[model samples]
Target: MREQYMRTGDGFLIVYSVTDKASFEHVDRFHQLILRVKDRESFPMILVANKVDLMHLRKITREQGKEMATKHNNHRTSGSSPSPVLWGAITPYHHMLSKCHYLIYHLTKRLCELLSTTCYFRAHKIPYIETSAKDPPLNVDKAFHDLVRVIRQQIPEKSQKKKKKTKWRGDRATGTHKLQCVIL
Candidate 1:
């Protein structure tokens, strides 16, 4: 059933939880499935790493998520294929006043986030952003806006395949393309 939707889809938003390794893993699998179903090596896709607010419980590194995207995209960043959708690879941190929430104090976490962005910009070349509901640098809305823009741009170009022209029983090729009104 999902395959059916994929077949007709103009673009895809593949999301995973930043805190869950399993969700990140599933993003990889889904990427493969989409390629198989659509039979295209590349398409307009956005990979979102959500739930960054749960920093303490993060099981997947930012690098891992970006690496997975680079792998699935076959390392080709541009040309002919539709532009990649803007992605949100978020990193959330806690404030002293927000003691009611859990927090992760690993020094490398922020470094990893910065490294992932740098890698993507320097090598992978995909539009990447970071979004967190409970943190700064939030971009959840921007991710969706980018998705809509990409889909609109790609869908029209992809559907440019020449459509077959059909004629009705009383139709004439030389006549106006618009249907003629008939009165009894």
Candidate 2:
């Protein structure tokens, strides 16, 4: 049943909890399953580490997640496979840009956010986003949005013409029956 969805899904989000070491270890099995089901060398996948709010309980490091993503990331896209999304630190305020240059201040701040996210992905690879679903979530929406972009990047431009939408109706409550692709 799970294989059925994997066969139909265009993209995947492989989510693992940062606090669960065992869950992180199980990622490879799921990844291999997706490949075997798709029978493809590469696919659009985003490796997500959730539960970031509980930093004290985190068992997986960000570096570890990134290394895993690089191993699983596919670079079929034309450009740097995985560029970036909005994230990272804010730039230091310039002494010259006082209260007088309020417009520059806002633009610079926005630019800084965009630039920070790209630094990690410049090498071109799968996105590894750490998220927390608790109140005041972080990167949850970004993860899904990035997955869409990744899928779009993989498809050939010629076939990108909009196709008729087909609605899928599922009878079971199982995750597989409703959507395509595994989220574990």
Stretches off by above 4 angstroms in model 2 are 66-125, 157-184
Q: What is the lDDT of candidate 2?
A: 0.49
All candidates: TM-score: 0.48, 0.54
For candidate 1, lDDT tens digit of each residue in 1-184?
5577567665565544455444433444455677788797666666555555566876655665456456544221111101111122111112211321122221112212223333443442334333454534355556556656656766677677654455444537666465445589
The number of the candidate with the highest TM-score is 2
Clashes of 1: 0
Clashes of each: 0, 1
lDDT of each: 0.45, 0.49
lDDT score of model 1? Answer: 0.45
Best-fitting candidate, measured by lDDT? 2
TM-score computed on alpha carbons, candidate 1:
0.48
* C-alpha root-mean-square deviation, each candidate: 12.0, 19.4
